[model samples]
Target: MKEFNALVVDPVGLHARPATVAVNAASKFKSEIKLSYKGRSVNMKSIMGVMSLGIPTQSEITISAEGEDAEAAVQTIEEVLKTQKVIA
Candidate 1:
């Protein structure tokens, strides 16, 4: 398993646009990826699940992946989040 933490930097937080980007990114991987916030965790590939968390600005989030491409999955998600300015 591989995991990394990030702080949401977007003023609007992880809204639909960023959440869609994240779900799209996670769907490309074969690994099981999860996003966690405020003690709740959801499948990163599911936009509904992610949005359900209602992650807000400055919130700490944990992304974790398990399986063959765990490391790559986590890295890709981290990059996507950063590029989208959803996290720093």
Candidate 2:
């Protein structure tokens, strides 16, 4: 498993637009991606799970992935977050 902490940088947080981008990026990985905040863990592929966290701008989030492509998954997701300007 690989883990990284990222802070939400998007002005609107993980609402509809960014959530869609996140989920799409997450879907490409074979690894099991998990996002956690405030002691709660949510499935990365589930939009509702992500939005339920209410990750506001500047809030820190932990992203972890496990499986064959865990490293790649983590890297890709990290890039996506950066590209979307979703993480700080």
Candidate 3:
């Protein structure tokens, strides 16, 4: 497993459009991806699961992935976040 920390930078947080982008990218990966906040972890591919975390701007979260493509998946997802300016 690989782990990394990031801060949610989107002014709107992880709701609506941002949430959709996160879940869609997560679903495309074969790795077991998880997004964690305040000790709670959720499956990255589940839109509702991610939204339920109520991630707000400036909130720090941990992302982890395990499986064959874990490293690549994490890197790609991290890039997506940066590209979308969702998290920093």
Say which candidate scores most in TM-score: 1
Write down the lDDT that model 3 would get.
Answer: 0.88
Badly placed stretches (over 4 Å) of model 1 are none
What residue pairs clash in candidate 2, if any at all?
Answer: none
Report the C-alpha lDDT of model 1 over 1-88, residue by residue, as the tens digit: 8999999999999999989988999999999999999899999999999999999999999999999999999999999999999997
Each prediction's whole-model lDDT (CA): 0.94, 0.87, 0.88
On the 0 to 100 scale, the lDDT of residue 60 in model 3 is 93
Question: What 10-residue stretch in candidate 3 is worst by lDDT?
Answer: 13-22
Misplaced by over 4 Å in model 2 are none
Model 2 C-alpha lDDT per residue in residues 1-88, reported as the tens digit of each score: 9999988878887677877888888888889999998899999989999988988887889999999998988898888888878886
Itemize residue pairs with steric clashes in candidate 3: none
* Model 3 ranges off by over 4 Å: none
Q: Candidate 1: TM-score?
A: 0.98
Per-model TM values vs. the true structure: 0.98, 0.92, 0.92
